[model samples]
Target: MLYQLNQLRDLSSLFTRKEVKRWLKDDFKSIDIKLERYNLHKKNKGSNYLKFLKETYKILEENYPNEYILKNEFLNKWLKSELGNQNSLIINEFRTGKAIADLAMFNGVSKAFEIKTILDKEYRLSNQISEYKKIFNELYIIIPKIQINKYINYDDCIGIITYDSEVKNFELIKKAVKNEEIDSNTLIEILHTKEYLEIVYKYYGHLPEMSVFTQYEVCKNLLSKIPNQELNSLFLQIIKKRKVNNLFFNKVNNEFNQICLSLNLKDSEKNELIKKLKTNIN
Candidate 1:
């Protein structure tokens, strides 16, 4: 049973459009195999597919340590509770410089979160935090309660958020100080070409006049001339403009918020997913 549940530990399959379609079409062959092996078929009898998924997730949370569980919990506590009504954008696996942030939240300011599960090693943690510090206004590392001591002597500028499975909640063990020394070059590198171009146009009052091949370098040079503080504000403003409709926040279950929001699903796909969650499975 443990092995079977471990196989589904990622819980990524439940978020994909292809998998959602297959399940909605009543194609349970693959799922049935795993459930049967885990001896959950009889225990999950008559529940809708969504209910079964929730139950499976609950079981997994109690039995295993995984990053997705941490992501979902953070989304619930930070995204929903703190910035629920704010004009914020939560990005998963956000790339900046040599590191990819586990989660990045943008509102009027930028915040990066690096998740460290008990199952993970701290081999590249320093590198990841160094990269994030260059681009984000605030930084946080989310870790399991048991691993708190490992980060006890870490920098106080970076916050520590701990997930205690006992209460299924995230606590801010340390408050992060806002990073005032953002690297303009690193920040600009992470922006989409169009976003940086817009920023250039915003500050310079005109877009750079360069060939397509040279536009990147030309714009980068122009953006680099702006004061760091102003450039950072512009970056946040442009990112927050990449909006997710409120329908997603209102319709999807909070547990699925991180994946669903990051998926950038079409309106039709979101509607289909919302409808399918209520679907019954024998």
Candidate 2:
């Protein structure tokens, strides 16, 4: 059962459209099926399960719009029309070597658009903004009205596009980044600031208590920000608390180790880290 839970957690983070399609093809509908069953149950336990599934789906949709469409036919149609092979818009293009802009518009001149479904008032779209300016003549971060106040001035290059029930309207705001834009070093500093880290820590620090699938989701987001060293420390903390059993811990640890190896961590370092972890757990 624990093994299955671990697998479900890993699968939930498979967010790209391609990944979700493959998941559906593989007869892996347990999460959705279980969610439906739970909704039908009258017990509070069932209610909690439904709530968790809804939250998980919400997070997935916000982070991976393309993937979300695989489960909802209406969304697929909407996105296809919005991003069709119109000469005005190019969908899913690799703008910079590092980032993929959700949609790029080349109307007469090069204009880039990064679509973000969820917006936090405090969190700035730093990476998307940097990539857009570096690659295109103009750039906009499209988000909902719920996040308008998060940004001070949206008149410059940083514009906000609000979505109605049916259509989206684009607003041309001022440029968010100036001639002396925030550099990579500065951006990293800001991300690591107490304010930013606090938000991240609040979201991720209590992850061990969450379901295995929930832990995986939180870890996926955390891996984007926290360094490998910090991740290793957190994993150790969870293990020491016996928050997850040995089998589950090993599974997640192996995944993290594989990610580190893919990032070109030296073979010796990889072996050393694995050895240390095994020794500590034993």
Candidate 3:
């Protein structure tokens, strides 16, 4: 049953250690093991099942490449290696207007990574990229080695990245061209309702008076009046200050660093996982 859970983790395309823990807890409950006992077992640090879970995940990761999961994992590691401790925000399933970006990072520049596995199709790719271009200054299509040929020019992808199974890292197959367009409308749309109002207040010193229903449209239009460069600077400032109160067990879980600031154990867990990953990759 334990190994089966690990199997399901990869097969699901997007699985996290957090979800696995929940599933494990449920399984233990079904087996009549109390949650307190399980917690106590971990507190005591001689958990054979916990050790088994780590070993099982390690073995599966080495033998099987679960397209999106491992690809995302490698990208996170690579980003950490490249970006280090720079002020940055990584968002998973980042929504810009009507489109949802697979992975997005905000730092020196706004960039997004759209992943396409062997099984994934190019059907909605045009629409996806069109929407991504609205806000993202850089866009990349991450695809497995097998699907690289199919996506080279699949739209106006700024770059293409592939997972090198042997090296266990993402290698850029094509350099992403920097996008000069910074769509303020899309950028304002990405902000929460309160944030939209806040930025507007910060810029012009007062909220635009409008009915409750017209507030969004009025706010968006007001935000558009700011020059793109100044708006870009404000966007960067606000996003960086976003508090990291959430917890993340998955080092690549998008909220990794933010949550790591509050949870030291999460940092250790991420380090341990990355350590094991390095060992296995080598």
Name the candidate that leads on lDDT.
1
lDDT (Cα, tens digit) per residue for candidate 3, span 171-227: 778877877666877877678787777788889998867888999999888888888
Give the per-residue lDDT digits (tens) of candidate 1, residues 19-104: 65576566766666666766778877777667777766676677664777778767766655664356777777889899999888
RMSD of each: 2.8, 19.4, 7.5
Winner by TM-score between candidate 2 and candidate 1: 1
Please list the C-alpha lDDT of all candidates, in the order they appear. Answer: 0.75, 0.40, 0.61
| TM-scores of all candidate predictions against the true structure | 0.87, 0.37, 0.70
Model 1: per-residue Cα lDDT at residue 254 = 56
Report the candidate with higher TM-score, 2 versus 3: 3
What C-alpha lDDT, on a 0 to 100 scale, does residue 265 get in candidate 2?
43
Candidate structures ordered by TM-score, highest first: 1, 3, 2
How far is 33's C-alpha from truth in model 1 (Å)?
A: 2.2
Ranking by lDDT: 1, 3, 2
Model 2 clash pairs are 154-173, 155-173, 155-174, 156-173, 156-174, 156-175, 157-174, 157-175
- In terms of lDDT, the poorest run of 10 residues in model 2 is 241-250
